[model samples]
Target chain A: MTTYYTKSHEWIRLDGEEATVGITAHASEELGELVFVEAKDEGTEVAAGDTAAVVESVKAASDIYAPVAGTLSGFNTKLSDEPTLVGSDAEGEGWIYKMTVSNPDDLKGLLTAEQYKSL
Target chain B: MSDTLHQTPLHALNLELGAKMVPFAGYEMPIQYKAGLMAEHLHTRSSAGLFDVSHMGQLRIAAKSGDVRDAALALETLIPADYAALGVHRQRYGLLTNDEGGIRDDLMVANMGQDLFVVVNASCKHQDADLIEKALGDRCIVTRHFDRALIALQGPEAQNALTSLCPAAADMKFMDAIETELAGVSVTLSRSGYTGEDGYEIGIAAKDAETVARALLAQPQILPIGLGARDSLRLEAGLCLYGNDIDPTTTPIEASLAWAIQKARREGGSREGGYPGADIVLRQAREGVSRKRVGLMAEGRAPVRAGAKLFADAEGTKEIGVVTSGAFGPTVNAPVAMGYVATEFADVDTALFAELRGKFVPVHVRAMPFVAPGFKR
Candidate 1:
């Protein structure tokens, strides 16, 4: 198992062909109290790096991009009613979506958990 | 961040409390605290939120001779509201307009005695003072209460939280004001505020303002709120800030504040006091304006923001209005915004669309005050 991060601040934890994706804690803190989170539909195919979600706060609006090329399998539907869960636990309970990693090699080029921490 | 920004007496206290500071009206003021905007905003609606509003200028206006109300009447000629009708110890919201009928600033006038009281706001205080001075002539005197610092203790906990600081304050009614001592400082306490809650705006002596603020913030419910939460909280309460909601380009009638107009002024039974754009004002009261400010409740969780274009959702691309104030309303726990739309779109069920990042967000034209106001009055 390995974790990868995008420059846009999204993270993907890859396990074979399956990957779990969510925004970095840094992104959530910067966004302030999360008021709304809009994730892509399940099975939505994206051409890697596409804006996959919208994250809103009391003060700002931001787009979350797809870190690795894949089809979104499902989303954390709990986000609609409890967006602050992202602020509370961005890495675990706050995971945004699960996807099938179309190209597992995409993970190698992304930032490691240690490298992402330095940011 | 601007070096030109002013600092309130409790500026250091706000920093000490880990507040998020922001520039507001040339002043470095706190917008929220470590609890952040949402918690502070929700707390203000449910409990109480202490705000350091010392950056706002508090001043006194009086007539050296006759009743200040009579003098205020003469001064009212320069404003859109009928000031002479205000009861002593009460307060009313008002605006200063130019010859074009556009608002110069929105302000609050508290009747201290028959002839004297305080008026306050940020950025517009100086100009507001000058306008009042120019209109008074020999009839009244306007003096700056620069020796004082203004603090707003707003919300349900306000009455109780203030009791420890000023015991006499508990007896005050909404919009009612009285001179009292708090934190060993003589202060003019007014049961008024911008957050649409039962609160008091305390004008403490400059030297003692920090002491009073410290004493108020000592309580658990009294979190130090800054400018960011101040904006969202007021939006939730459906209160208007001068710059975003009303400005030089807007008018009282257009702003939907015609209630501030004195009934006598509309009747024309008394002497007609001269003021800028009085003719157009009376005419507006008789008929109505083409546009009006109304509340908007979105169909989804995506909140409409200020400057978002408003269009008829069904009619397609026809631009009708634009949002002036907006946010996810903390009190109502939903997104709400206020904007000016054509009179035809001001009804409760009028369907509208807010263009956000190219997406047309569905909206409905609702009444003002997205949430209920808890002013003591």
Candidate 2:
């Protein structure tokens, strides 16, 4: 399994043809407390950098972009009831959704964990 | 991040408490502490929360001839309130009006025996001071108290926390002001606050502000709150933020603040039409305004923010008005907002749609405040 991160603070863990996606901890912290989360529905085809989800805090709302082109398979519906999980565990239990990578070459554009931290 | 931002007397203490400092009204003040905005807001509703409001401008208006009525009448010329009728030790809410009948700023005026004490918004202080000086300087001595620091103790347990410091403060009713001593420092105490909760606003010497704040925070029920929670609290309480809910383009009647205009200043009264914009304001009071401010409750969990346009239909074609102040009200456990709407659509429970994130979200025009106020009176 290879884990990649985007400059916009999205993280993806590639497992064969499928990948799990969520926002990075740094992005969640900057957004403060999360009050609502709206993820894209299953079977939706998304392009890289397309808006995939929305996370709202008490102060403002932020959009989560797709890290790589793929078909969204499922979302973590648990976040709909407990949005703050994103703030507590952004990269783990708070994963936003899973998608099947349409173009494996898209993975090469992502950054390693160390490179993401440096940015 | 600019070095030119002004620092309050409690600036060092806020840093010590791990507060997030942000620029507001030319001052680098705390937006929230380690507890965060939601925690601070909920804590203020259930327990005691201390706020460093020294950034607000405090002024003293005294009569040149030492007559309190002279100063009150002089102030009445600038604002629409009947300050001359304001009894001793009583305070009244007022607004500074321009010649066009628009609100310049909202303020609190207290008849504190020899002088009328005033507090104005921090962002409008300089202009407020200059306007007062230029308008009434000949009849009254307008002295801005930059040497003073203001603190507010708010919440259900606020009285319990404050009474421990000054026993007399607990007896003061809502909108009452008195001189008292706190932590050995002479201070002015008022049984009023911006939050809907029952609380007190204390004024003290700038040198002793940190000491008073420390002493209050030492109490078990009292926690230091910041501006983030302050905004949410006042919004839930249906209070108008000067720059948000009320501004230069909003008149008293248009803002639904006609209650602040006393009978003496209205049409067919003893002292009719002496203040600024009396002709238009008094006429509006009798005939009514074109648009009015109202509270809005979101139909869903999605928060509708300020500047979002309001539409007459769900399809969002006809734009009626725009949201002025909005947030996820922690106490109400939902998204709440206040905005101006056509007077015809301002009735309670009038269905409206707000354009949020490209989709029109259903909203209802509800009567403010979203939460009931807990004033001591």
Candidate 3:
């Protein structure tokens, strides 16, 4: 398994064709407290860089874009009642969704952990 | 406006406390701290929250004769409030009205015995001062206090924390403004705030602002809050932001603030219709306005943001109004908003639809003060 990040701040962990995704801690910190989040439903086909979810913080709302094109395999239903999880634990239980990658080549375009850090 | 952003007297202290700075009214102000907006808002509701509101403009209106009543009478020419009847050490919410029967800015006016202590919004202070000087300059002396800082101590435990330093603060009723010393520093303190919480707004010398703010934050029940929580708190409280819910294009009558216009200033009263746009305002008071401000309770968790058009039906036909301010209310735990709607649809519980994203979301006109106010009065 390998993890990659997008310049827009989402992180994706790839396991074969399956992957999990969430925003980075840096993005969560900048967004402040999360109040509401709505993710695309399971089975929805999302393209790379499309808005996979919408997250609202106390200050403003933002879109959580998909890093790679895929079919959403699962949605984080718990976020509806507990959106703050994204800010409290962005990389773990706060994961926004799971998906099946459409093209493995898309992974090569993503940033490494070190590259994401500098961004 | 200049590209250079100004900093308040408490800028360094706010930075030290880990504040997230943002540009507001041309000033770099703290929007939230390390605990974030939700924590700061909830903490304020349960305990006390310290806020640096020094960016607001503070000024004093004094008559050449040294009589506050004379000053009030002169000010009555600009605003439609009964300031002349305002008791000593008492504050009243007021507005600067334009000649066209519109609101220029909202303000707080405290009768300070010899003069009226006025506070205006940060963005409008300069223009407000110029207006007062241009309009009432002959009868009243308008002195802008650029050297003063305003601090707000709000929430449930605010009284207890404030009394710890100024015992007289405990005796002040709501809207009471008194000159008192806190920790040996002189401050013109008012038993008032915008957070719908029982609290006080302390007007102190800019030089002593940091010292006074530090002392207040030192209380066990008090935490430093920022503008993010302040906005949510006021929105929940149903108070209108100067430039948002109310503006130069909106009149007090249309904005549902006619109550602030005392009977003395209304038609057929003793001192009737001396203020600007009095003819139009008085007529509107009697005949009613076409549009009215109403509180909106969004049906779902998604906040209906400002500028969203309101429709009579879900089909997006028949546009009725526009949202001016909306936010996810932390205390209400739901999306709360305020907007203008046709008067016929402005009644409480009237169902309305707000266009959000690309769809019309069902919202209802609800009574304001989403959370019960905690005023000492």
Candidate 4:
């Protein structure tokens, strides 16, 4: 599996035709505490840059954008009861959702970890 | 974003404590610390939290001839509250009104021994000071306390922490103010605060502010809270923020602050119709306003925010009102908000919808003070 990052702060790890997605640790830290999370329903089709999720802290609410065009396969339901997971381990157990890649070529638009860090 | 933002006396202390600094009211102030907004908010409710409110303006309104009643009467011409009936050492919430029946600002006025101590919003301090000077200059002397700093210690354990420093603070009830010494520093301490908690607002000389703040934080029950938690706390308390909840376009009656106006200023009273906009305000108090401010509870976990439009139907076709302040209440464990809606729809249990992210979320009208105030009174 190889991982790619987006400038919007989402990170995706591709495993064959499926991918796991979550926000970067830096993004979670900047958002402070997580009080609520809303993910797109399973099986919903989304395009790149579409708002697929929302995360709310005590101070403000932010939208999490889809990194690439895909069909959402599933989402982590644990976030409904324990949103703080996003703040505790954003890049691990805090994974927001899994999706089936609609077009493998969509990976070309993502940045490598090194390139994302430079931006 | 401006490099010229003013810094409070505790600016260095905040940075040292790992606070996220942001610009507010022309000052670089802390939005939250390392513990984050949620923890900071809950901590203040369970124990005590110290806040830097030095950016607010404090002023002394004194009569040149040394008569306190004369000074109070002079101020009565500008606001609708009955300052003359305000007992000594007691504070009253007041509103500065324009001649057109609009609100200029909301403030706290305390009757000290020989003068009136006034605290105004940070953003409206300069304008308020100028208005007071221009209107009442001949009758009273208005002295702005530009070199003073104000700090608030709020929570259930606030009294315990404050009384430890000044034992006499224990004698004060809510809204009481007294001049006393705290750790050898002369200060005016008031048993009043924006947070709906038992707390004290201490006004001290700017030079001694840092020392006093450090002493308060040294108490085991007290932690430094930032603006983020302070905002959520006040919102849950159902208190209004000046610019957001009550602005120049809002009237006291329309804002559901009719309780702040005593009977002496209303119709059938001896001093009726003396203050600016008294005619319109008094009429509204009797006839009622077309719109009123009310509390709202979101049906789901998603937090609704300010500027969210309101609708009467779930279809979200007819816009009825707009939210002014909204946040996730740490105490209620749900999303709460305050907004202005048509008077007919302001009743408790009224069904409404708040448009968030292009979708309407179900909301119900509810009574304010989402969490019961733990006032010492």
Task: Identify the candidate with maximal DockQ.
Answer: 4
lDDT per residue for candidate 1 within B1-377, as digits (tens), equals 77787788887888899977878778888877898888888888888988888877777777777577766776677776666777787777777888877888777787777555756577888888788887876678888875467888899999998898789888888888788788788888889888878899888777887888888888877878767788887887777888888888877788888776666655473634256776776677678888899989888787888899999864448999999988887667778899999988888879899998667888998877877889765
Sorted on DockQ, highest at the top, how do the candidates line up?
A: 4, 2, 3, 1
For candidate 2, the per-residue lDDT at B64 reads 98
Task: Give the fraction of true interface contacts kept by model 1.
Answer: 0.44
The collision pairs in model 4 are none
lDDT (tens digit, per residue) of candidate 4 on A3-116: 789999999988888989999999999998888998888988999999888899877989888899998888889999899899899989999889998887787789988998
Question: What local distance difference test score does each model get?
Answer: 0.81, 0.92, 0.92, 0.90
Which regions in candidate 3 have their CA more than 4 angstroms from the true location? A41-45, B1-3
TM-scores of all predicted structures: 0.90, 0.97, 0.97, 0.97
Give every collision pair in model 3: none
Candidate 1 lDDT at B46 equals 82
Model 1: residues with Cα > 4 Å off, grouped in runs: A6-8, A15-19, A40-50, A66-74, A97-110, B64-67, B137-139, B267-273
Chain A alone, TM-score for each of the models?
0.93, 0.95, 0.94, 0.95
Interface RMSD of each: 1.0, 0.9, 1.0, 0.9
List DockQ, one per candidate, in order. 0.57, 0.70, 0.67, 0.79
In the predicted model 1, the residue pairs found to clash are B30-B226, B30-B227, B31-B226, B31-B227, B31-B228, B32-B226, B68-B115
True contacts kept of 4: 0.70
